[model samples]
Target: MTLLFAYTSLYGQTLNYDVIRNDKSMGQTVVKRILKGDELTYHLNTKTELRVIFLFDIEYDLKETFKNGKLISGTGFNTLNGSVQKETQMALKEKFYELVIDGIRTEINETNITESVSEIYFEEPHHSKRVFSAYFGRYLNFEKVGERQYSLTSPDGTNVYTYENGICTKVKVTRDFATFEFILKPESLLAVRNKQITGKTND
Candidate 1:
């Protein structure tokens, strides 16, 4: 499952979310969006650690650059157990998108330039098959289930996203016997932050 925020305003903002599994805090995700001139940059960072018989941890970092609503470049790295396992980079050429995975370059059709789960946050009408998964390194298809709900299916599992005011509030992914959920922090927290900012501005 992917956690994404749709920014309606050009102003920069950062979003924080808590990842949960079995009603317990598993990890957190941080997303930041910045706009400068005609370009928009998005950064996403995720970390998860599970301790059972042995300690297992994973981290994913991604950055995407968009110009005029089209993705121009992307780079990401994935680490498992504190060691980098995979790295990927992509750039849009004149007519095609070049993807390099672990030093291997592959040319992708220009029409399929859309390649990132976070891109769903910028999608129009809230439904599309143009979304991509970096973990799978392929595009996934999605269907709108409700006014503010959508579902995406991949070989690994199905992910359902619920949004509030176009911002993804909850995501549930079910794969076989495991189900994971990630939810936005309470609105009260956000309201408090806004109130503090407003108070400072007035002072």
Candidate 2:
């Protein structure tokens, strides 16, 4: 806790979460933030190993840069078994943002792009309508469900996030593979190991 406190006070915050599937620990996700002058950087990565008739590994990485609270660039990569599956890049332009997924490039006409999918780990969304998904190179709609909780729905599936204070404590992901949850380490590590969070469920 001392290290976490120091990190929270100095550079930024480090949130460690245990990836749970069927009440079992599969892997983990680590999120970090660094504040320097007028530039802020957020990084996140996830490692999940499970069996789908056979044993395989999956990983996802993301990095986002913000200058004066405006998104400058963001990139993400998804891999399977150490091989790259998808790569996405978003760079800021004059009045629009240049977004490239795989090798295809597109233009986003939104000015002052701020938040994306990765920022949800550090701050809670009280009235956010949507957040940009770098992996999908699109915007995902956000819906406020219960207190301090919000849901982001995409073509893939719906992801529910629960927050405390101003930080996210839990993320419930409903995907095609299976349903899993990311529980904030140490702080909520014990309370959520047994039961699921009570709130609105996507149907």
Query: Candidate 1, clashing residue pairs?
Result: none
lDDT of 2 by residue, 1-203 (tens): 96875555556656789999999988999988788888889899999997878877999899999998889998999899999999999999888989898989989888787768778876676555677887877778788888878988888898899876556788999989789999898854433233221111222
**Predictions in order: lDDT:** 0.68, 0.80
CA RMSD of all predictions: 7.6, 5.5
Model 1: lDDT equals: 0.68
TM-score of 2: 0.85
Residue-pair clashes per prediction, in order, are 0, 0
Residue 45 lDDT in candidate 1 = 88
| Candidate 1: tens digits of C-alpha lDDT, residues 1-203 | 11232233344655667878888887887766678889878788889775556766979898888888788888999898989998999888988878889988887776445446765443322456457655566778778787667899998799887754445657787877467786767752363244311111100
Q: Which stretches of candidate 2 lie over 4 Å from their true place?
A: 1-8, 187-203
